[model samples]
Target: MGMEAYQAQFADHLPGGGPAWLSDLRQAAATRFSSQGLPDRKVEEWRYTNLKPVQAQLFALDAVSAGAAPPALLESSYRLVFSNGVLQSGANDLPTGVRLAGMAETLSESPGSLAAHMGQINAGQDLPLPALNQALSRDGYILSIDPGVMVERPMEVLFLSDAGTCYPRNLVLAGAGSEATVVEHYLGRGDGEYFVNAVTEIHAALGAKLRRYKIQQDAFGASHVATLAGQLGDDAHFENFDLNLGGQLVRSEIHMALAGQGAEAALNGVYLLRGKQHCDNAIQMDHVVGATNSHQDYRGILDDKAHAVFQGKITVRPDAQGIEGHQLNKTLLLSDDAEIDSKPELEILADDVKCSHGATAGELDETGLFYLRSRGIPEAEARQLLMTAFIAETVAHIGHDDVRAVMERLVGEWMAQ
Candidate 1:
C-alpha cells in the first residue's frame, strides 16, 4: 500500500475537536508523511534497515481485544496500562508536584500546557516516521514534574499490543531541579500480526535529572518502530537504556541534544536476537553547547540466522569546547549464520573536544568457554555464563535495583531458550 492509501484509510477516522493548533499540526504532519512516504534503503540513515516488510502489509486501525495478562510489574511504582493503544487503567495516587494524564484528556483539560511542548523538538526535521505518528496517533500519555520536586518512585507505562497497528505518541517534561525515572514496557499478547509505531518527546530543564528505560518484547509476528527525541538544558542529566528482545523486524532510534553547558547524556542498550529476527539501533548525539558530555554503550547477542545493526554518531559543534563524548558497540555472534553490522562515528568540529568511538563484532571467547567447561560446568551453562558476563557491564548501568533485577531475569530466560 502507498502513503496516499494509508492517509485515505486512517486520516478521516482520527479523533477530532481538539485545539486548533493541534489540528494544524496534525494536518501538516500528514501532508509531510504523504509527500515523503516510508523511507527506503537508498536513504543513508536507513541503509542498514529495510522497511519493505512494513509497507507490504495493510494494517487495520482497530486492534483485536486480547485481554492477556501483563508482564511482571515493579514492586512499588505508579503504573499506567494501555491495550491496543487505548488506556485501560491509570494511577490516581500521584504524589504532589507531579501531574499525569492521558493525551486526549490533557488536550481537553489543559490544551495550553500540551500545546507548549507537543511539536517543539522535531518540528522542522524531514523525519517521515515521526511525522506519520504525529499525524495518526490518537492516544498516549503526558507526564510533567514541577520544579524542584523529587519523585522517589518510578512511573511505568505499559503497552500491550495484540493485532493491527497503533501509533502512540508520548511526552515527558521535567522541570528545573526535578528528578524522576520513567519506564516503558512493550509486550505482545497473542500470535497475531501487528505494528507498533511509537514516538516519545522529552524535555529536561536546568539542573533536572531524568532516567528513561524501555523494554521491547513484542510477539514473533510483530513489527515495532519507535523514535525517542530529547533536549537537555544547562546542567541537566539524561540517561536512556533499551532492552530489545522480540519482534520480527525492529528499529529503535534515539536522538539527544545537549543544548546547554554542563549537560550530560548517557545511552546504553542490550539486544538478544535469535531465529530470523532483525533488530536495528540508530543513535545520534549532538553537543550544541560547550562543556557537554555524552556516552554510548551497546551490546548484542545473536544466534541462528538473526541479524542486527548498530549505527551511532556523536557530533560536537565548532564552538563546543571542553566536550567529552565516547561511543562503543560490541556484538557476540553465537552461530555461524548470525550476522552483525556495527558502525560508530564521531564528527568533531571543535578544537578542544575529547571524542572517540569504537565497534567490535566477533564470536564468544573460546578460551573463556573452555576454562568454564574445565570447572565441570556443562557446555551450555558455560555459554550462558559467558553471555551473561558479556552484558553485565551495560546492565550495571541501570540506576534502579528493581528494574536491573528484572533485566537479569529476562536475560536468564532468554539464555535458557
Candidate 2:
C-alpha cells in the first residue's frame, strides 16, 4: 500500500488530546510526514541503507494482538512497560526524587508542562521519521528528576511489539545537580513481521549527570527504527550506549548537542548480526560552545551474509574553541560474504579544537588465531575469544557495573551463535 492509503486508514485515530497548540503541532507534524514520506537512499544521511522492504510491507497502525511478556532485563529496577503502544502499570514503585508518568495522563492533566520541551529539539530540521513518530505516537513515558535529587536505583522503560507498527515517543528531563540512570529496552514476540518507529529526547541541566542505554532485540522478522536526541547544559555529563542484536533490518540514529560550556558527552555502541540481517548506526555530535568534550566509539561483529554500517560525524562551531572530540569505529567480518561500511567524519571550524576520527574493518588476525590454536584451543573457541576481546575494548567504556555485566553476557551469547 502507498503512504496515502496508510495515512487515510489511521490518521484520524492518532493519539494525544491537549490544548490547541499540541493539536496544531500534531497536525503540522502529519503534514510534514506526508510531504517527506519515507527516506530513500538518495538522501545523503541514508545513502548506504535502503528502506524498500519496510515500504513494501503493510503494517497496521495499532497492535492486532497481545505480544509475549518482556524479558527480565531490569528485574530489580523500577520499570514502566508499554505493550503495543499502551502503558502497563505493573512494577511502578519508583523511589523518592524520581517522577514518572505516561504521556496521555500528562497531556490530560498538565499539557503546558510538555509544551516547553516537546517538539523543541527538532525545530530547525525536518527529520521525517521523528516527525512521523510525533504524528502517530500513542503512548510513552516522561521522567523527571527534581533538582539536587539523587536516585540510587536505576530505571527501565521497556517496549514490546507484536505483529504490527508502534510509534512511541519518550522524554527524559534531569534537573540541575541531579543524577540518574535510565535504560530503554525494545523487544518483540513471535516470528511475525512488524515495524517499530521510536523517538526519545533527553535534557540534562547544569551540574547534572545522566546515563542512558538502549537495547534492541526484536524478533527475527522485524524492522526497527529509532532516534535519540539529547542536549547538555553547563558542566553536565551525558553518556549513552546502544546494543543491537536482533531484527531483520535495524537503523539507530543519535544526535547530541553540547549547548553549554564545559559539557561532556559520550556515545558508545555494539551490534552483532548473522545471516541476512542488516544494521546501521549513525551518530552526530555538535559542539556549540567552548570547553566542550565528546567521544564516540562503536564496534560490530558480522557473520555469514550480514551487513552493518557505522557513520560518526562531529562538528565544532567557529566560536567553540578549546573543544576536544574523538571518534573511532571498527568492525570484524567473520565470513567471506559479510560486509561493513565505516565512516568517521569531523568538521571543525574552530582554530583551537583537537579533533580526530578513524575507521577500520577487517577479519581476525591469523597470527593471533594460530597462537591460540598452539595452546590446544579449538579454532572455533579461539575465534570466539579473539572476537570477544576485540569487542570488549569498546564495551569497557560503559560505566555502570550492572549494565556492563549485562552487555558482556549479551556479547557472550552472541558469540555462542
Candidate 3:
C-alpha cells in the first residue's frame, strides 16, 4: 500500500480517544511525520545508520492490549509487562514506594509531577524517533519513587511484541535520596519483520542512585531504535549498560545532562553483531555545572558483513568550571567486509577543566591469536577467546555480579554464532 494508506491505518488504530493533550499530540504528529518524511542519510546525526531499513517498508501500528494473556513470570525476577505499547500493572510485581501503570493514569493522578519531566530532557531536532513516539504513542508505563524510599527489587520493563509493529513509551521518575534499578528487555519470536520504536525519559533527584540495563534480541528481520534522556542532580549517580546481540538494525541514543555540581554519569555499552546486521551507539553528555564528572566507554565486535558505529560528544559549558570528563570507544572487526566507525569529540569552554576523548577501530591482535593456536587451541576457539577478552574490559565495571555475568554470556553467545 501507499504512505497515505499506512498513515490512515495508524491513525485509525488510536483507541477511539480521550484527553485534549492526546488529540492534540496525534494531530501534531501526523503533520510532523508528513513534513519530516522519515529522515534520511542526509542528516548528520544519522549519516551512518541509514533509516531506509524501516522507511522502505510499511509498518502497521499494533493495537493496545494492556492486559493481554497474563505476562509470564520468568525466573529472572521482578518485572512490568508492556504489550503493544500499553502498560499493564496487574501483570507486574511493583516494589513498594512506587506506582507502575499507564502514563495516562499517572497523569490523571498527578499532572503536575507527570508533565514536569515528560519530553523535557529528550527534546531536540536531532532525535527523530523520540519525536515520532511522542507524537503517535499516548500510553506507557510510569514509575514514580517517593522521596527517601529505597526500593529493594530491580524493576524490569519487559516489552513483548505480539504482532507486526510495536511502540513502547516509558517514563521514569526517581525522587530525592531514592535508589532503584531498571532492566529493559525487548524479546519475542524472531519471525515477523517489524519495528520496535521506544523512548524512555528519566529524572534523577538529589542523592538518587539508579542502575539501568538494556537487553535487545528481537526477530532477525526486525529493526529497533531507543532514546534515553537522563537529568542528574547534586550527588546523583546514573549507571547504564546496553547489550545489543540481535536486531537486523538497531540504534541507541543517550542524551544526558550532568545538571548539578558533584553529580556523576557513566555510559557503558557492548554490541556484538554478525552476518549482515547493523548497530550504532550515540552518546552525548553535557557538563552543565561546575565540578561535575562524566565518563563513557563502549566496545563493539563485528564479523561477516556486519557493521558497527560509535559517535560520542562531551560538551563543557563556558561557566562549567573544574569539569572532569573522559570518553573511550573501541571496535574489533573480524572480516574484510565487516566495518566499524568511531567518532569522539570534545568541546571545552572552561579554562580549569580537564576533558579528553579517544576512539579506535581495529582487528584482534594476530600475534595473540597465533600464540593461542600454537598452544594447541583450535583456530575458532582462539578467535572466540580473544573476542571475549576484548569486550570484558567494559563488562568488568558492572557492580552487580549477576547482571555482569548475563552480559558476558550474551557476548559469548553472539560470537559463537
Candidate 4:
C-alpha cells in the first residue's frame, strides 16, 4: 500500500477525536507517510531485521485507551501515560523549568520558540517508519529549558500503550548554557499488538549539556520505533542511552549534526532479546564543520531465537577538521539460533580527522568465565558481571548519578530476574 493511502486509511478512522491542531497534523502526516513507505531489507541500513511481521499485523496508528484508563503501574517509579497517543495524567505536576504541554500548545503559545524546529527533521529520507510517524502522529509534549538554567531533578516521561496502538511525537529543546536530564520510558500494559511511532527532537545550544535515557518495556506483542534527532551548537553536548527490554520488534534511528567547533555527541544502546523478538539500532552522525567529537557504542545479548541489528555511519565533511569519532558494536549469542548483524562504518573526507569503527560477534569469553569461577563466583552472576561491565563503560560517562543509578538498577533487576 502507498504511504499516503495507509495514512489516509488511518486518518479516516481516528478515535478520541481532539481539537483542530491534531486534525491538521493528521493531514500533514498522511501526506508524508504516503510519499515515504516502509523501508525494505534492501535498504543497506536495515538489512538485519525483516519487518514483514509488522506489515502482516497491520496495527492502527492511534491506540487510544479512551474509556478504559491504564491500570496502575505500581512498579514504575515515574511514568507518563499516553492512551491513543494523547498525554494522560501525571503531566500536570512536573517540576519548575520543565514544561509538558501538547504540541498544539507549544505552537500556539511558543510559536517563535518551536516553529523553527518543529517537523524540521525527516529521517524519513531513508526510513519508512519515520515518515509514517510524520504522517499519522498526533500531538505529543514539548520540554524546554531556559538558558543558563540547571534542572536538578531527573524528569521521567512514561508513554504507555493499551489495547489500541498509537502514534506519539515529542519535542525537547535545551537553551544555551543549560543543563538537564530526561528519562523517556515506553511501556505497554496489555497483550495487544500496538505500534509506537515516536520522535524526540533535541537542540543542545552552545555550552549546554543534556542527557537522554530511553527505556522500551512494552509487552511482547507490541512493536515500536523511535527517532532521536539532535542538533548541537558550538561547545554543546548531547548524550543518549537506550535500553530495549521488551517488544516483539524494535528499531531506533539516531541522527545528529554538530553545528560548531567543540561540540560532542554520544550514542549508546543495549538490547536484550529472547523468544523470537528482534531489535535494531541504526545511527548516523555528520560533522559538518571542525573540531567536533562523536562516539557510538551498541551491544546486544540474544537468547532463544532472538535477533538484533546495528548500523552506524559517522561522516566527516571536507570542511570538518580536527574531528574525533569512534564507533564499536559487540554482541553475545547465547543460543545456536540467536543472531546479530552489525555494520559500523566511517566516511572521512578530512585529512586532519581521526575516525575509526569496529564490530565483533561472539559467545561469552571462556577465560573471563573461568576467572570468575576460580574465585567461587557462580556462572550466571559471573556472566552478568562481565556483561554489565562491558556496557558500564558508556554508562560511567553519564554526569548524573541519580539517572545512572536508575538505569543500573533496571539492568541489574533484569539480570537477576
Candidate No. with top TM-score: 1
1-417: candidate 3 lDDT, tens digit per residue? 344754665576554345565556556655556556676879877889988868743346645452343343234556667666556543255666787677766666665555456666744323557766766665677778888888776666777664556656777888899988777877756355678888888889999988888888766688888888888999899999988887888889888999988899989988888888899998889998988999888988888999888989899999999999989888888889999888888888888898878888898899999999999999999999999999888888775666777677777777787
Candidate lDDT values, in order: 0.88, 0.85, 0.77, 0.76
Q: What number of clashing residue pairs does each candidate have, in the order they appear?
A: 0, 0, 1, 10
Report how far off residue 209 is in candidate 2 (Å). Answer: 0.7
lDDT of 1 by residue, 234-294 (tens): 9999999999998999999998999989999999999999999999999999999999999
Better of 1 and 4 by TM-score: 1
Model 3 global lDDT (CA atoms, 0 to 1): 0.77
RMSD of 2: 1.9
Measured with C-alpha atoms, the lDDT of residue 109 in candidate 3 is: 66
Lowest summed lDDT window (length 10), candidate 4: 70-79
- Candidate 2 lDDT (Cα, 0 to 1): 0.85
Query: Tens digits of per-residue lDDT for model 4 on 1-417?
Result: 765567657656543344455445545655655665666789777677677767744455434464444443233333455655776755555556667566655656654666566666654323566656655556676778878888766667777775565666788888899888778878777666777778888878899999888888887888887888888899999889998998998988888988778999988878888899888898999897899999888887788999898989999999799999999898888789998878777889999988889998888788999999999999999999987876677667656677677678877887676
Off by over 4 Å in 1: 1-7, 56-59, 123-125
lDDT (Cα) of model 1: 0.88
Clashing pairs in 1: none
